[model samples]
Target: MPMAADEIVSLIVAGIPDAQVEMTDLAGDNNHWAARVVSESFRGLPRLKQQRAVYAALGDKMGGVLHALQLTTAVPVQE
Candidate 1:
């Protein structure tokens, strides 16, 4: 079964707490996703680590139920 956008966002929020997540169904199949994640926690992390955090949020679902995810991560601009 494919995961829903809400589920994805919920997982991320649960993991990061302060994360703001935007999810897109890239293929309309609910399997392929593009996620833009922004959080203060990601501020000093390397891009690889930031992405890994998001993937970890999804837990063991990635490459299985979640399929492919095109992820973009960033720290919220201080303003």
Candidate 2:
């Protein structure tokens, strides 16, 4: 079974406490998703490292329950 959008967002936020996560179901099947996350944790981190953190939060679900994730991570923009 594919993971729920809220579940995925919760996991990401749990991992990155300061993260702001927004999720969109691109395919409406809960399999394809796009996530835009802004986090202070992303500061000074490479893009790959930021993505790894998100993936780590999902555990084994990456290839199992979660099929495709389009992820974007960035340091929070200044107001």
* Residues 48-67 of candidate 2: C-alpha lDDT, one tens digit per residue: 99999999988888888887
- What stretches of model 2 exceed 4 Å from their correct place? none
Where's the lowest-lDDT run of ten residues in candidate 1?
Answer: 60-69
Q: Which runs in model 1 stand beyond 4 Å of their true positions?
A: none
lDDT of each: 0.93, 0.89
Q: Each model's TM-score?
A: 0.94, 0.92
Error of 1 at 36 (Å): 0.3
State the lDDT at 72 in candidate 2.
92
